[model samples]
Target: MKKKICVIFGGESTEYEISLRSAASIINELDKEKYDIMTVGITRGGKWKEYTGKVENIICDRWYDDSLKDVSVDLGGADGALIVYGNGKLEKVKIDCAFLGLHGANGEDGTVQGMLKLAHIPYTGPDMLTSCLGMDKAYTKIMLESAGIDQAKWVTVNDYDRDEIMKKVVDAEEIFGYPMFVKPANAGSSIGIGKAKNRDELMSAIDNAFKFDRRIIIEEFLSGREVECAVMGKRGVVRVSCVGEIKAANEFYDYEAKYSDKVESKLIIPAEFKDGIEKRIKETAKKAFIALDGKGYSRVDFFVNEDDGTVKLNEINTLPGFTSISMFPKLFMHEGFSYAEILDRLIEIGME
Candidate 1:
């Protein structure tokens, strides 16, 4: 029997558009001979709909239509099912597994995973705790620190009041000195990330970051080569792919530089590294994945200090982008897996 695969995307997160593109890419690559595919889109307003539209519509932000059926997951039954109800009609669609093409916030950070768990449906990516930890930069850092993984020095802020935020900013300035990077603890695709070279920029950066998440993280700016490695499989038996480097068109790899077609961002596969640095990076990547008790797959980022070759762990993306230009699939492609093959492996692991 063909496996019934539901590719869930279009989350309420800031990375919603990226999720659409990622889901379309995955849906296009999935073997029609081996699987029965379904697409579920979550609107920005948090409505779940079963999208029966062209993949092109997903890419062009035209997937939403009146034809879409209002949907919900069946958490009350033993059989894993998706409940589609509209116009006084009800239907149940059995899902063998869910390919979570979601990024950031509600979908990626454990909300959807918790629902799938309650429904007893196996889904791609890590479990609820791991997803929550991986989505929150503060928790990721805490986990990495406990594992003794080398990373940049950082601090987290949770207070929303302007006076309290400014005090925290002063403390951060004293600790990290001049230039620093501020980002939301729970955002992705560089949605609310900024670099502040002075106190005014720092305050502005904090204010902007808090707009996306209640908590924000500030890290000391480290000048290094931006590199990343793709990891897969469950904890203690993970596979690390060859590294890739990102050459951002802007000062940093922000949301626009990451997704916009107008900007020219270059990605170098098998990114050049000196001597044993690549090996160390791959090792660190595995360590970071294991630290999160990662499952299915993730993309681990890092910064390789050009002057000293120090590899500082950056972050782990549990549900990395699956777009044509995404680093995760591309890095695995360099490691001898085709895009479809990568999906096959992920689905197989997710089922397990």
Candidate 2:
């Protein structure tokens, strides 16, 4: 029997457009022979609808064209089903599992995971607590600290008071000096991230970052090569993939450098590093994932100081991107898993 799979995409997230692209890619690769596919799209305003349009429409941003039926997970029921109501009728669509093609905000920060947990639906990626911990950079730093993981020095700003913000700015400057990275504590895909070299730029970056979330993270810039590793599987049985490096065309790997076609970015898989550096990074990747109680999959990033070969842990992305240039799949594909095979393994893990 073919299993019915619900591919959930989009959300009230800054990465909504990226989510659509990732969904389109996954929907295209899902084997039609073994699973029945269903797509649900959430609009920027948080409206949920059952999309029956062609997959290409999703990438073209036309998936919302025409009338689409209102759809929602049946949270009140024990069965893993979605309720679609429109045209004076209600239909129940049972799903065996859900592919969470979502990023940032309510979708990746455990909101959608909580809903699926209530609906008794198994979904790809981490559970509620893990998702919450992974999405919030402040909390992720806390977890990493507790695990004895070495990351860049950072200060978290949660207070919105003018005086408090200024105080933090002063403290950040005194501690880390200039040229810092400011990012929203709860955003991903490089959204709401700014690099500031002076005090004026730092203030502007903080203000702009706070616009995306109530809290923000300020970190001293670390000069090194940006490398990443892909991890999957549940606790006690995790798997790690080859490391990859990013050579951003922009001043840094901002959103544009990551996704824009106009910008030139280079991705080096099986990144060349000194002996034992790659092995140590892979080991740290597994350690960090297990420390966070990560499940399903994640991409752990790091910064390698080329001079002394010191590795500093970067953030862990619980639901990494699936876009054409995404490193998650590319790293695994280098390990001999086809895109479809990767999705298959994730689904199987979610079911288990």
Candidate 3:
């Protein structure tokens, strides 16, 4: 019998559109012979809808037009089953496992994971605690520092008081000097990240970041190559994929460079490196993932200094992007893991 999988996507997040794109890709690629698929979408306003439209429409952003009217949750099984109320009746599908293509805020920050846990259902990606830590930039810093991992110098700013927040921002620049990065502590997909080279820009960046999140992470920007690695499983038996490098067209790897300007930005698979550097990066990736109590899978980013080859931990994305051209999938694909193979492996691990 086919496994009844509930592949949920499009959440109340800044990455909502990205989630839809990813969901379409996965739904299209999943083998019909192996699994029974239930498509669920959460709107930006947080409305849950059962989506049965063509996957292509979801990718094209028109799934809400026609097919969406065909399905709605059956309140009978309120425990989060993929239920559908159609033809004047209620139908509930008992999901064997769930694949969350949701990102940022309510979805990626352990909210959905906790919900699934309460429902006693298996879901893909890291467990609740790991998801929460992975989404928190400040907590991730604490974990890395405790593990003796070298990372960028950072200061977290959460004061609603403009004057106090301004003081903390200046103190950070005084310590690290020059170019700094301001990011929302819990946001993903580079949504609220800004690079500032001067104090004026620094202040503006913080103010802009606060619009998206209550807490913000301010870190001294490092001049280095932007590289990343994809990790799977947990602690002892974790597997690391090949190293990948990103050359952003913008001054920094901001939102535009990540999803908008495709032709300008470039990704180098299996980044060329010196004798021991690649191994060091892979080892560091595994260690950082394990140190944060990371389970299932994540994409660990780093900045390798050019002059001295210093590898500094950037952050861990518990549930990274799975789009066709996404770094996580592309990195593993380069290492000989097909997209379908990766989906199957992740689903199997989630069941465990």
Q: Best by lDDT, which number?
A: 2
**Candidate 1 wrong stretches, greater than 4 Å:** 160-162
Across 99-212, the per-residue lDDT of candidate 1 in tens digits comes to 999998999999999999999888999999999999999999999999999998898898655557767777788887879999999999999899999988988998899899
lDDT of 3: 0.85
Model 1 steric clash total: 0
Question: Which residue runs of candidate 3 sit more than 4 Å off their true CA positions?
Answer: 65-80, 261-263
Sort by TM-score, best first.
Answer: 2, 1, 3
Model 2, 304: alpha-carbon shift in Å? 0.2
- Cα displacement (Å) at residue 11, model 3: 0.9
- Global lDDT scores for all candidate models: 0.91, 0.93, 0.85
What is the TM-score of candidate 3?
0.94
Provide the TM-score for each candidate, comma-separated.
0.98, 0.98, 0.94
Quote the positional error of residue 201 for candidate 1 in Å. Answer: 0.7
* Each prediction's RMSD to truth: 1.1, 1.0, 2.2
Off by over 4 Å in 2: none
- What does candidate 3's lDDT look like per residue over 216-282, in tens digits? 9889888789999999885578999999999988888878888884547889998998858888899
Q: Over the stretch 229-305, how does candidate 2's per-residue lDDT look in tens digits?
A: 99999979999999999999999899999999899899999898886899989999999999899999999999999
Scored by lDDT, model 1 comes in at 0.91
Candidate 1: the clashing residue pairs are none
